[model samples]
Target: MCEKCETGVEILTRNGEGRRNFLRGGAAVAAAPLAAAGFSGSRAAAQPSDALAQSEVQAWAARDTDGTFAPYTITRREARPKDVVIDIMYSSICHSDIHTYKGDWGMPNFPLVPGHEMVGRVVGVGSEVTKFREGDIAGVGTMVDSCGECVNCLADREQNCLNGTTFTYDSPDQVSGGVTYGGYSKRIVVTEDFVLRIPPGVDLAGFAPLLCAGITTFSPINHWDLKPGQRYGVIGMGGLGHLAVKLGAAKGAEVVVFTTSQDKLEDARSFGASEAYLWSDEEGLRSQMASFDLMLSTVPVAYPMQQFLNMLKLDKTLVNVGALFPVEGAHGMMMGFGRQSLAGSMTGGIAETQRVIDFAAHHGVAATYEMITPDQIGEACERVVNRQARYRYVIDMTAA
Candidate 1:
């Protein structure tokens, strides 16, 4: 669920010192008056990018720090060498988008179009681009660029670029001129290296969230070397958790789901969980003590760490794929006593992200999403904020 879309924003805004400036810093360039950036403000018009040519495109944007989304126009850079111009077809809303848009991560680049889980058809490619071509289906995730020479990038982990990574939106784009705008627009220009090739038969809309949710869960399972026939526990049944259920089951693990909602038990079982237990069921929770070899948590808010830590076997791990908010009663003794480990993971790097896409396609796994038209942005945002959507909410750009 997108429960974090609302509550997480409140938490971060209250606790984070630099959050209010999220829009201020990026807004300076994004919301600048005409003369400051050499614009006339008459109508959306093409302008020079940091490259050869650029075009202003139609998009939905939040004009202020309040994050009320509406129709607005933004510009996208023209394709340069190693760049791919994509006509975005679908964009899935992630909780991070909510946090960023609401200035929880600090004020975002105002006039901001927030989206990172994007899938599209390529319309143009630069001279030096070899990874993708025109007419091919491609996808872009949370990041758009990173210093290729960095150690992490060299290791195929661009998400952790030592020199700092460029996010798909709200970051300075040296090559594009203004702060990066995401896929809420009709088109986006990204370097070929950062773009992903979608498999021929995958469902584009259902597959879009994999760019973020899929890779996030897959990276840790892959990193921990989850072997076949091992016991795996998935906590939470939201977007990330649902995918984790499928991926863990696909890996041949005896997957279990730990959720507070009894209604989701059927969904969890259908997603391949061998068993589902309610978190509030003390008897059910107690029966699983020191049982799982590994546990992956996708809960979007701050949760009791010790209870989850207790689920791990000796030397086992409980990996968190959700919010990094402060935990109220986290004590090292939980892990220290059992030799268990607690860790956190972010979205995966490029290679691992692609692996997730291909693997998911092979396993016939994808997000169960609610499709919304452009005009429904406000309602969609509210639905996600209230956790009322089925699982994920995807913007259908082609809808009228």
Candidate 2:
């Protein structure tokens, strides 16, 4: 058995009865009618208290472009009728968090508490919330809310909502007025629809990266409809790249990895990749041209795109889940010859995020991560920026 599965077995042994009861309770609540739950379809009538009570909580924040984190305190709004209050246990550091803090993406709002991948236990639930209850294992990902009535949201693609999707942090907070504080803090209040239910027995720290790195890669795989025995390619072997390998292999694809680091080639193979190659392996890469049915690039920085696009089969696609910047070196001729396409994917929506979580649990796939205390967040972010993190860095919120 994999190490993740063995750890899960230990957790299950410890929490077996509680997990069963939690599952049963969740199902019963889901089946209950809105009327029985004291909820109504009207938005105005269902609104929570206008007073918006707030409480101060401890956290870490980046005060400037230096990206140095220091002790801070932020206020959290009390749970509304449709919200869930989670006491955060683990928060995973994502590369984007560093980008935002360092102003690489843009100048974020000052005093930014940067974290989106979080897993914790529910401590409070709004009166009308039916999806979760106190003591349930839950998670919050890259997004917190969206306009539910938009065309995209109606179709279950909340990430592309017509009005605008509210990100977990550094986005406008419709309720609290300034901005939404993220999971680097001790507690967070999120709407019930945005909260994800986590499988009971998995390692919470290992499972935290699934909120961002896992979903970012899985969304494209799902959209492309990757099938059994298909050739799959992943570029870069960082946090996102490794998860792509595990997820793709779990779906029965013959997964291959391409990376600049010689060390990660072997690591990729251990992560279920059928083959791994360095980008410098011109002969090996050229041999695989026009052979891949689908490819995903998880490199956060700019890299040559033409080589990967050339490897896609006719009518196939190379999806970019990272590199928010404009892609260069991808000429029209490279794509026109093969009738191939280049696409981009954001993080998954609510339902899709939940699906990835459940899928990871069932497949025994978990991130290889190093644990750190909240005080070490700055050093951890530095390591991530320097490409030193082996896979992921997860914050142990309970530690000093």
Best candidate according to lDDT: 2
The alpha-carbon deviation from the true structure for residue 255 of candidate 1, after best TM-score superposition, in angstroms, is 1.2
- Candidate 2, residue 227: CA error in Å? 0.5
lDDT per model vs. reference: 0.77, 0.82
For model 2, name the residue pairs that clash. Answer: none
lDDT (Cα, tens digit) per residue for candidate 1, span 235-342: 888878988998888777899999877788899999899999999889988999999889998887787778878888999988988866765456787679999888
Q: Write the per-residue lDDT of candidate 2 for residues 314-396, one digit (tens) a residue.
A: 99999999899999789898689989899999898777777688779888999999999999999998998889999999998
For residue 162, model 1's alpha carbon misses the true position, in angstroms, by 1.2
Task: Flag regions of model 2 displaced more than 4 Å.
Answer: 1-53
